[model samples]
Structure formats: structure tokens, C-alpha cells
Target chain A: MTDLLRTPLYGLHLELGGKMVPFTGYDMPVQFAGIMAEHQHTREKAGLFDVSHMGQVILRAESYQAVAGAFERLVPMNVLGLGEGRQRYGLFTNEQGGVLDDLMFANRGDHLFVVVNAACKEADIARMRAALEPDISVTYIEDRALLALQGPAAVDVLAAINPAAGEMKFMDVATLDLNGAQCWVSRSGYTGEDGYEISVPADQAVDLARALLAHDDVMPIGLGARDSLRLEAGLCLYGHDMDEDTLPAEAGLVWAIQKARRAGGEREGGFPGAQAVLEQIASGAARKRVGLRPEGRAPMREGVELFATSEGGEAIGKITSGGFGPTVGGPVAMGYVPVDLAKADTTVFGELRGKRMPLSVTSLPFVAANFKR
Target chain B: MKYTEEHEWLLPEGDLIVVGITAHAAEQLGDVVFVELPEVGTEVTKDEDVVVIESVKAASDILAPLDGEIVEVNEALTENPGLVNEDATGGGWFFKMKVSDAAPMDDYMDEAAYNKFIG
Candidate 1:
């Protein structure tokens, strides 16, 4: 317990009888009421989450264009095309084109703001510092805390507090007065729902959270339901679904690579591991990420070996993230397998414990996405 | 009836003892989504892990209360694992084992003692 860090909302969580567990470096709640009930509530109404543990970095330079260009050179996204108050999902890759972390990049008028996973914060910051030019200065915003208000009723609840919230589209961001405290609010979340991720000063965090919870449709959610929600939506977690050993192409994140960044293109910018990424784009990756649906009620958890039937029942893949998807009403998983066997409806086998469980390669986003965009 | 320090409850039935997680333990575990039980006829030692109970957040091992040979497992857990959350001390029995050494029963706490222990 001495080693675990606490967020600004720790006191509030304890007051609400949240079951705290060590996650990353913070003592976070795994659940509040319960996982299934909280999950269903979020799907039907709204769920409030304390995400202050995530890293917030501000990139400032002489001009916003310079910082944006410097950031674009480090990742594969089209950062320059982003308008003010717009946010886009980006990934930080290693020298081998493997993802280090997936993060959100926002063009905040004067400067570029970025938010990354808590577990990968140190490494991500070091990587950016090493890659960016000397002119670009990246500052860690340790004085801020982040909160997510998510689900279908999120707009209604937030609109009640700030009527302007109803006008914001998905992936767009704006500075709004949340309980009279100016904060950065982005219409984005990891739960595949219509939600707002608000960044406020640490001191104002508890007040904002309390104000949001006062809404009739909003309830406190914890990490337990967060994982299930993301799993059900087929979203890949940073450490589980990908790592330095996994290339972006093989991880089924080709969408993150803008078309303008393709090989032999005029707008193509030089970045580390550009040659390997281009080659992967042209020849196609050897293996690709896919969703797996196991037969029966048994779950195919991480580290489960996958066998390809066409190749003499060869072990060609491994489960990365797997669990019981409450919304899907069964067990679901995502893993990487040979490109040839990554097609939807393809038969596969997962070795669970000592028994072989029948599985099938299926399309991702097992549940429908409810983003307002 | 007796309870182990690990929060497992046992009731004598014929030559076997019915084993189930306590209500207090179930409430702490939140929702029980999956259960992995040992096969009948398998031998287990006291305090050794013999069953797995998974919630949406994590998976925990259920330790055997005493050394014995497993005689039966709860097949109901295969389809409706939430029984452990609904009635952990009653219908949610995990398995039954034929006692290998009756001496270990002395180490278990009686109902009143177990209640005081939890309190």
C-alpha cells in the first residue's frame, strides 16, 4: 500500500466504498456497485470515471505549427491537417514500427495537448524528448486531473450543466466552464460511447466530479467495468493487445497510418522505421490482429495459444486480451494470427488449460459503437 | 458445520464434506462470472488450490479446506456462475470431497467461532 499512488479523487472513492486495487502505479477502484451493473448502467445512461492517473503533456514552441509538425514527424498521423479544438488518436512507435503507446493528440489553439496512458507515461515522455527537436519544449502538466463522463445520457447530463456541450461533435474539443471552472473538454472516450473527457486543475477535480455525479443519469464507474466496456467494444489495450514486439500493421491499426504518409507519396514525411512500415503496407504484414469468439461459456484468456487448422493444426497465434463480455452475452477475445487465417468466420482452436476450445476469427467491435460522430 | 480461515464453509454429508465459499467472501469478490472446478477423483492436499473463481475484474483460486479426494463438482456453475454471489453459503457449493484424514477437522472453526472470526 505504501508503494501505490493515489489520485485526487482517492478520498471520494474511499467514501463511496470503492474496492481499490493497485493498477499501474495508482490505487484505483476495480468496481463500485458491481461490474455488470455498472457496465449496463453506462450503456443505458452515464458513467463517471476518474482518469487523473493518465499523463497529460503540453507541447509549446514559438508557434503551434512548429510543435504540430514536430509531433507529426514522430508519429504516423496527419497532425498538420487537424483544426483548432479537434482531437485525434495517435500511437507512439518504436524504431521497429512497434507501438509504444496509444494516445490522444489535441490542437488546443495556441499549443498542442496530448494525453497518454499512465503506465507508459515515463517511457513516452522520454521517447518524445529524445525524438523532438531542441526548439520544441514538452512540459508535463502535473497540476491537472482528468475525468470522463460517458454513455448515451452523457450529453443530456452534461448539457444540463453546460448547454454548449450538446453542440460538440465526437472527437472535437472545447474549453468550457464546468461549474464555473474553465476546463478542457474533449468529446472522446475509450468506452466506444458518446462522452466527454474533461481536464481540470487538480484542485477543482473533486468539485467537478461531485457536480457531475449529482446528475440523475450519472454514476461512478471503476476499472472493472472500464475493462469490460473496452473489451466488448473490441478496443485494444496498450500492454495486452500490443507491445514493442508487435508492428502496427500486424496489430490491425493500419487506420492510424494516414494515406498521405504512404511510400512514394509527395506528402510522405521521414520518420524512424519508415522503410519497414512502408514495406509492410506494400507487401502486407505476415500476421494480423483479429477478434476471436470461443465456443461455449468458457473464456479464452490472455496467453492462450491459437492453432490454424489449415497448417496441420499449427500454433499460429496467441490470445492478447480475453474475458467475459457482459454486453455480448458470452466470452470474447482478440489476438494476432497469420494474415491468411485472419479472415472473419475462419475456424481456429484455442488451448485453454489442457483442453482445446473451438474458436472462430470474427470481425472486431463485437458490440456496436455509440460515438456521437 | 465449520469454516476455514480462507473463508470456505464445510458441512458434513455422509462420508464427505460439502464445500462452498462464505457469503462474506462472495460479497468481497463482487460478481462471480466463471468457475473452474477440479475433476472428480482428483486428490488434493490441505490448503492447496483446487478451484478457480473468476469475476469481471480478476480470477482467484479457491483453496482446499482439507486433504481429500474430490467426489463431485458443481455442474451448475458451468452455466450460471453467479450462484456463488447469490447464495455462496448454500446452493453455491463448489465441490464435495471424501475426507482423507479426519484429524484436520479439528483445525476448522465452528459456526459461532467463524461468525466471531469474521466480525
Candidate 2:
């Protein structure tokens, strides 16, 4: 605990009565009001999140095409084709067709701005430096703090501070001035809502967060609500849902790999695990990540064994991430199941405390995405 | 009110004792989302897991404080689990039970001792 790092908003979190907990070596706020209330608040109005723990990096080179082409070798995404001022989700794949880490990268004109998960930031940065450095500069933006303001009312609240924010569409990134601070703003978020993730200077983060929170529609949301919101949105948490051994196709993240990166496309079979990933893309994966709705109110949390039958002979798979989804008003979960049982409305059993409970296999995103697109 | 080390509170009422979690336990558990209660008239042993309470963060088992038969269970918690977080002591009581031994009640902590123990 003594060695835990504190974010830029640590003092502000304590002032706001946030329950601080150790998350990825950082003493972060797990909740302020409560998980359930914060969850509902973000869905209805706006919620401000202090996400400074995530690593922000800038890759620079002679030109945008040069940097994009270098980055395309590490991941299976069409980085070259990504439009300027647009963000795309990407995965850093290993040689075994597994994900090392998942990230969001945007083409910031002359350079690329990337954000990776807190738990994997160090390794991700090291990997990027080793792979792309000397040619394309990988600079970790440690002086900035990232804040995500998300919900249906996010645009209205942010537009009041910076009217230009309203003009940006989903996934569009721009440099905006908020409260005298030049912020790297993106009209996107992890909650599947129309919102913005503002990267502000560390010193100005509190002012920006306070300014946003001053709005009646915007509340201070902690990591607890953030996790629930992402889960309800069917977004995968880096380590929880996919890891070093989890393949993109198996984790339902093949969509992130554009057609150009697939077989027969212009730039195909050049990524780390292109052979296996392309094979899975063409032939289909044996197992798939599917949404699970527990029959009862009890949440079938991670590590709970899943079976094909109530009286099963052997466990088929296990839940990756699961908990009470506040927006759904019940337990929602995601886990790997055989492709045969991954169909919607299919019934599977999760063994909880020695009893087999039925769970219905459903499509992703229990709550519909409210993105402005 | 007699309190157990597990953060359970027992209120003596004739042959039956009203059982519920303390406010400290409720706060520790965060927002209670689901509560699974044992059936009425079910026999329970001391230190045995009787009720299952799940908050948004995690799930925890409420151990039986004394050897008893569950005379009545809190049905309201089944509909709205937040009642436990709202009123943990009064209307949020978990169940009423008839214990086989009243001697154990004296061994448990009193209000003062429980507060000190939590502190």
C-alpha cells in the first residue's frame, strides 16, 4: 500500500469522498457515491471519470504514412487506412495469435496518440519503443491526465465549455481549448455513449474535472461505475476478458482487424500472428466469447465453470468477466463457450457454489450503444 | 443487541431472535444487489453459511450466528435488495429464528464491545 501510485486527482477524489482502492498499483477511486447510482447517472446524464492511470503515448516520424506503416507490423489493424483525426481500437498480438494488450490509437495529424490499459502500459510502452523506436519516436505522455465524460448529456455539458466539441462526430479527435487548457479531445468513450475523453495537462486536470462536475448533468464517477458501464456496454477489460493466450477471433475482437489486414486484402499476412489469425478468420474459431445472462439474480462471476448440461460430466469453459450490470437491472456476464453453444437464446449452465444455474447465451451489449456516430 | 464477530446483529424477541447485518457490514459490502435467503423453518447450525448477499463488487455469505430454526425470512429483500443498504438494522432485518441454546447469546459481544471490536 505504501508503494501504490496516486493519480493527479487523488486529492480531488478524497475531497469528493471517493473510496480509494489499489488498482494496477495506483490508489484509485473505486467509487464516490456508489456503484449502482453512478452507473445510472452515467447512462442518463453525464459522468466524469479520472483515467489518468492509463498510459498515453505519442508516436512520431517523418510523416503520418511512415508511422502508420511501422505500427501496422505489430497489430492486425489497418493503421494506414485510418482517417486523420479518427480513432480506432487495436490489439497488440503475440506470435501465438494471442493478445498482449488492447489499445485505442488515433491519428493526431503528424503523430499518433495512443492509450493503453494501466496494467499493461509499462510493457506496452516498452514493446512499442523496442519495435518502433529509433525510426518512429515513442514518447510516453506522462505529463497529461485523461478524463472521460460520458453519457447522453455529455455533448451539451462539454459544448458549454468548448462549443467546438459539439461539432466532432464519434471517433473524431481534435485539439480543443477547455478552460484555457489545450486538450486533446476525442468524441468517443468506453461506455458506448456519445462522450469525450479529454487529455489535459496534469496541473489543469482538476480544473477541467471540477468544471465538468459543476454541471447538473455531470457527476463524479469512480472506477466502480466505469467497470460496470463498460461491462454493460460489452467492452472487454484487457486482462479480465482477454490475455496473452487469448486469440482475437476467440475473444470476439476480430472486427477490430479491418478487411485490409485479412486474407486476400492489399496488406495481409504481415502481422505477428497473421498465419493463425487469418486462418481463424477464414475458417472460424473453435470457441467464441458470448454474452451470458444468468437465469436468476445471482451473478455468475469470473472463474465460474460453464457446462453444457446441468448434470455435466466435465466443465466446458469459464466466465471471463461477470457481475451485476446496474443498467440491465440484473446479472450480465461474458465468457468463452464452444461455437455450437454461442448462438443467441442458447441455454448453458454455470456452476456456482456447486449448483448448476441456467444462463442464456445472448448477443453483446446488454444495453444498446448511444453513440452519436 | 448482541453482535457477532462476523458483523451480524441479533435482537432478542421472546424465543426467537431477529437477525440482521450491522451498518458497518452494509457499508463494507457497498450496494447490495441480490440477497438469497434460506427457506423458513430450515434448521441452521452456528457458523454455518445461511444467507448469500451479493453487492456490485462481490458476493459474501452471511453465516448463521447461532444454532436455530429459521422461523421467518425477510421476503422484502428478495424484491429490493437495496433495503439492506438503506436500513440495515430496522426494516432490513434478515430473518427471525428460534435458537436451541440461549446460553450462546451471553457469549457474544454487546453493543459497546461490538463497536470497540469494529474500531
Which candidate number would show the highest TM-score if scored against the true structure? 2
Per-residue lDDT of candidate 2, residues A1-373 (tens digit)? 3699988889999999999999999999999999999999999999999999999999999999999999999999999999999999999999988999999999989999999999999999999999997999999999999999999999999999989999999999999999999999999999977899999999999998899999999899999899889999999998889998889999999889999999989999798988988898889999999999999999889999999998947888899999999989999999999999999999999998889999999999999999998
Which 10-residue span in candidate 2 chain A carries the lowest summed lDDT? A1-10
DockQ of each: 0.61, 0.85
The local distance difference test score of model 2 is 0.94
Ten-residue stretch with the least lDDT total in model 1 chain A: A308-317
What does candidate 2's lDDT look like per residue over B1-119, in tens digits? 99999999999998899999999999999999999999998999999999999999999999999999999999999899999999999888999999879899999999999999999
DockQ of 2: 0.85
Q: Candidate 2: where are CA atoms >4 Å away?
A: none
What is the C-alpha local distance difference test score of each model?
0.88, 0.94
For A180-299, candidate 1 gives per-residue lDDT tens digits of 889999999999888999999889999989999998899999998898899888898999999877777888887888877777665584666677777787889999889999976777
Model 2 residue A7 CA deviation in Å: 1.1
